[model samples]
Target: MKEEMINIQDPILQLKDVSISYSPGKNAVKNIYADIAKNKITAIMGPSGCGKSTLLRAINRMHELYPDIKIMGEILLDGKNILKMNPMEVRRMAGMVFQRPNPFPTMSIFDNVIAGYKLNGISLSKSEKEEIVERCLTNVGLWNEVKDSLYKKGTFLSGGQQQRLCIARALALKPDVLLMDEPTSALDPIATNRIEELLLDLKQEFTIVIVTHNMSQAARISDYSMFMYLGELVEYDTTQTMFTNPKDKRTNEYLSGQFG
Candidate 1:
């Protein structure tokens, strides 16, 4: 298993000339091309409605949520096209955490984290599931806060804690890739810093692709950055390079606030 993992490709995910359209004539993403680095943070930054969220959703096949939307082009994970896999299997392979802290309002904190396993039909012994809950919560730095109140409703927690619970839920699936769409956008500065710190630690175990409108967050957390404009990727480079000296004028303009 170690040998096979080592021999694998550098990109955990590859988007080859992909284009996405919601309807017959409405193209949300056009001629998009990019790769997500393995075990590192790849930041996707662009103006709102420039297909930023749409492009991130495509990685885990979340575009399938919209029946009217259609995707063309290959999205490869470990050199295999994701389109060939079942939507459920693909989602399990790449877990997603949304922009909001959306822990189930009715479920307990313990139930929320391991909900993925129960919902996905993956079986584990009672103690094993308990362990998964503890481990995942600890991994996301929420264990200490909620350890004693694991049985309490998820929504009873603060907004930041709810978001972290959602993260723990995704992590429970043991996904190879974790996609975060503006995970910190709604949180306070302290909460945002904690999430950023956790993300830096998470990439040690799994690939991370993040979409953030915050340029400072992107510069601080990402190993690499890809800039998209008008539904096209304009620059893909090391985070340092992209933030310091971008190759594309559009990227530079966007970064400098000349235009979005």
Candidate 2:
């Protein structure tokens, strides 16, 4: 079925006829076309192996890490086609946070936040690094908690704090969009609530595309929502509309707890 469309006056990102395949003639994500509005929280929800993560990873060309995977599409970020851009540059513009908190085990809290600049071979002076570290940590609401322990290893922090630190690391690059894959899944309820609140604040500054399995989370935080099933986009609409009056039978079923 064709995905529902909503007119976005000036979308920050556009996915045009996107498809991904792990093997020949077998696509994990079928052609998907959508316009992502600026500074809004958009959620992608679907059952396992439905290509939510595959589609998200393709936004920043993460699929390039595997030799056999193939992606065909035009992913435009701020009017530039990211598919043809340098992978490193694409990643910097659209920073990603994974399902679990993955702070570099070897790096300290301060160093982890600026890891992107170091990895990109971009040099920063002592003061510049300090400024970025503080700003990013403050953005993720982790500054005061770990301020005194800036030199401590990131892995020493709690799961939720580590995830926030990971977010701070991603934000340090000053990305245009933030891509999250089940970011709060590994944390406790309190921690999850904190991350949700953080995301709400973040949408004011950055466009967010999150792949989540939790429908409640989507309803609570997303401005727009996409429901994908079996590699195809089943529906896309405002969270309120989609929840109360979905256009597709599959979407209604999924939302009704009839199926995952």
TM-score of each: 0.95, 0.98
* Per-residue C-alpha lDDT of model 1 across residues 1-260, encoded as one tens digit per residue: 01111122477888877888988877888876677779999898998888888988988899886899888888998888998889888899888999989888878999999999888788889999889999999999999999999999999998788989999999999998999999999999999999999999999998999999898999999998888887777788889999898888899999998876
Worst 10 residues of 1 by lDDT: 1-10
Which candidate has the top score in TM-score? 2
Q: After superposition, how far is residue 181 of candidate 2 from its true place, in Å?
A: 0.6
lDDT of 1: 0.87
lDDT score, candidate 2, position 4: 28
Give the number of the best model, judged by lDDT.
2
Candidate 2 residue lDDT tens string, 74-185: 8899999998999989999999999999999999999999999998899999999999999999989999999999999999999999999999999999999999999999
Off by over 4 Å in 1: 1-9
